[model samples]
Target: MLVILDLNDNNKLRIDMKKNKSSITLSSLCGIIIALSTSCSVMSKEYKTILIHGLQPQQLISASATNVEADGASYWSSYWGQVSDERIDWPSYERIEGKIATDWIWPKLKQFSEANLCDSGCVLVTHSTGDLVARYIIDNQANWLRNAGLQPLNIVATFDIAGAGGGSELADIAVSALTGAASWSFVIDQALTWWLGSDVTEAVGVLHDLKVNNARKISPVPDDRAPRLRFVADGDDFFGATKLFLKGSDDGVVASHSSCGASRVDSFGSCSRHIASDGQVGHQGNGVSGFMPNHYPMLMSDNYSHNSIRNAGHKGKVTVANYAANVGGKQVSFQTYDETTGHWFWKKQYRFVADSNRLSASELIYDAIP
Candidate 1:
């Protein structure tokens, strides 16, 4: 018996098995390909979305302990629903050393890599210190996988929510309070307890990693080209307590420089290279001019707090009154609504204020997913 396959004159697949012959039209061939693509595994592409969570108060208290109830690692379920296929949970109390990424995180990632689960590509959603951890992964995952005789992850992009990759000044302050480097005032003690759920008199494990300079020193720039999309908020959820410790504009916990992926920690009002003196939301511009390499700020809101941005709850409504070419620049257009007159259009800069309805930051981020 013999078999042969070839394209017919009519652009159809003609297969001959011994004395029997059959032809499949182009549409039929496409249908067959689609049907067999699953069994043909090697030809199919699988895309996965992985969620890496931020620091937990319980983890911050003790690296060796686990408090499932206090951990927000599973909060992504509310924001993204059931889209995430994998979740990477790490102890926020561990340093970015042997145990944190090398032992704890690596095993999970290695398993996924070895399985070639994301053969096509993946989108990572990380929050706070997870952003810092992801940068390390992006920098080393490929080499680590190849060294282990496995395939590397094809990370298409990363969504960094309240990213602390640039490090938070609060970490520095916390260390200062712990080491007695700075005066341990009543205010500092209260703030740390409020945030960490404990006195946190000792800065151990990951607290050192969260220090502004230290975090920046760890894989600040990744070799991978995956873009880091940042979602930031300027609301003071901590009741204006932690804000004094942070620089410029902040999402209560992290300063805008860190959240926006600024190359250097500074007082930056907006993530864009341009800023408006009159105060307008900085719509993140493309490229690496104003931000860290491969980092791009996506959404910004005055109403969204650090915690609210990651949840499914509706914060409230906001009105976009103007659109500008750049922050602080002349407004190119404007649209405002009034109770009596309805929407009025004109030329102005981009401005968001407390008013009519708009999507929450979580919804906006979810919608932005490709």
Candidate 2:
């Protein structure tokens, strides 16, 4: 079992992450991009911590994947820890439903929730396999967090960056090889390790759970999710490398269709999964992205890729739109951008104006970049 890192129990991990923070930034200096709160004295409602899992680092000496909280604490702190308040954590890579996870492992999650989460709730910023672990806990641990004194805090913000909600082709191959379910000749046992690229380790990698059919089983989302759910996924990233295993568009590790959480489509162009955004004010409900029949879905785009979408708090490609509506006069305009190419189709956009207010509380936009 692997415990990643956090503020309370991970003092060592914190130090390690601080040391490597600059390296992570240098590695993805050009990474594409994409939070909140308020108060009079700016009192924090609850512990606003960032929780991350799934994509941890590999242990160099053991040829195994290191527990984020144990071995490569620096890697996580260096990367995601910088994304939010002050920290995150490590989780066991054991099969999520297995006793290893149920008995000794997942309790750590419950403990983490009880310790950090409060009225403000915590923001879940997940990526790739992190989505799978978070989905299970978010839907299943509602009562647990509530019992821990989290409150109607049942609702909270979730940011899925390059979410592998659908599943990954690499996982399919790994699962087949491990279980001997599919043709072993296609990818022998040793070859599967090669595909792993160094994940072979003492702990289970949770790849079986990431299989397509298995992953799709994670729907209908429970009704107890927050109103501000956001998913940022792309179809392509490592074109030169993904082609070897991925048959369709992928974000190096996840398929585009899977990453977007787009499960169903109709002849009429309507989709069961990718629900279009309901608009600004209409976002105060369970149905985020218009597809909340079961699971809390997200607004998606195909113009971007995975791996390169991690947020580092940079303003390189950010756009801020502020507005207030009262009688609301009329103004309308349109702009287009090809997200996949990372280029806007238009240089500028025009917005018509209506009547509004001044020194408003704040603004929250849930759109393509949400």
Candidate 3:
């Protein structure tokens, strides 16, 4: 006999069977296991979030040695920070190499599959050169998802901060300098040695090869049809100058010109229909303090520089606010607070409106995703 336990949560029920029953058949136990497993599976299969850090070679070391816990989000196991070995590829270099290597494919695929938090789908939170890696994963891992019995649903969201979505002008400058087109080979070499380590020559060569290969497949403009939540900060030093130097438009660190799609506003306009305006929030001034001030040259000088801007201490609030405004439902809610005051700014419970425009890059990512 099956005893039904009413789980307080509607649509969920638990079952209990008496242990003393000698007549309990194997088929009956199988039925009970199947029922419980199905319920647990449904519970486990919900919208999951993953954080993918970009281009730091050091992350690989940490992943291998540290008891890294989930930072409230699944972290792709990879070395993404500084490196002691010059021969090892950094995050940026590895991404390019991984794209070329057939074996690297399974690791990325498994990373996503094991983090099956997104029964409904998932959101990819990425930063800097990491956005390129995210794109590479999405483009190449479609087969992996199919094999794992998972479907790529709405991206749910994407947060790209100071992304080098378009190629870096600094990269161009380095190439010119090293190739004798520019007169700053000595200075360029010194800078590379100082930041990228003594192995600058090999790193640069690897970067160049990756860039060339990436150029063939990826476009500056992301597909409009893909449902995404995006954000861009204004004072982004890299895109801004890159816009002038490469594409001829300002994108904080990455030039909008180099970016594959329309200008920021234009891209927003096209995707605005999918973005929910009610979920929108905007910030004024440099997103963070303590960052160096030089705009154009910073991209080349500092490895951390980018064109994206985000509000200080307010990213979480903005994310919660935007998610609720654009894509609300029982599974979603909104929350906000002030950094300086430590005060609640906004809080609400709501469901997504189907007619709302999808969240844009300007809405969710800039200051928050990191």
Worst 10 residues of 2 by lDDT: 355-364
Q: Which candidate is the best by lDDT?
A: 1
Off by over 4 Å in 2: 1-47, 57-65, 86-92, 99-109, 112-116, 145-155, 183-195, 198-205, 227-230, 233-239, 244-247, 265-305, 311-370
- As for lDDT, the candidate ahead, 2 or 3, is 2
- Please write out the lDDT profile of model 3 over residues 1-370, one tens digit for every residue: 8754445444434445665323332323434566455334323424444455434422333334423233212223222111100011123343454443344445544555565544455556555454555555555455556676765433454444544444445556545655667676555555444334443443332245324224324533343223333333333332232333333333333443222222321212111222222223243121222111111111111111232232222211122213332321322322343222223666433222222124333232321221
Question: Which candidate leads the pack in TM-score?
Answer: 1
Candidate 2, TM-score vs. the true structure? Answer: 0.56
Native-vs-model 1 lDDT? 0.69
Q: Write the per-residue lDDT of candidate 2 for residues 216-298, one digit (tens) a residue.
A: 67634655444323344333444345445653444456654555455432111111222222122212222212333333333
Q: Candidate 1 residues 36-69, lDDT tens each?
A: 4322332222446688887776655555567532
Quantify all predictions' global Cα lDDT against the true fold: 0.69, 0.43, 0.36
RMSD of each predicted structure: 10.6, 12.8, 13.1
TM-score of 3: 0.45
Better of 1 and 2 by TM-score: 1
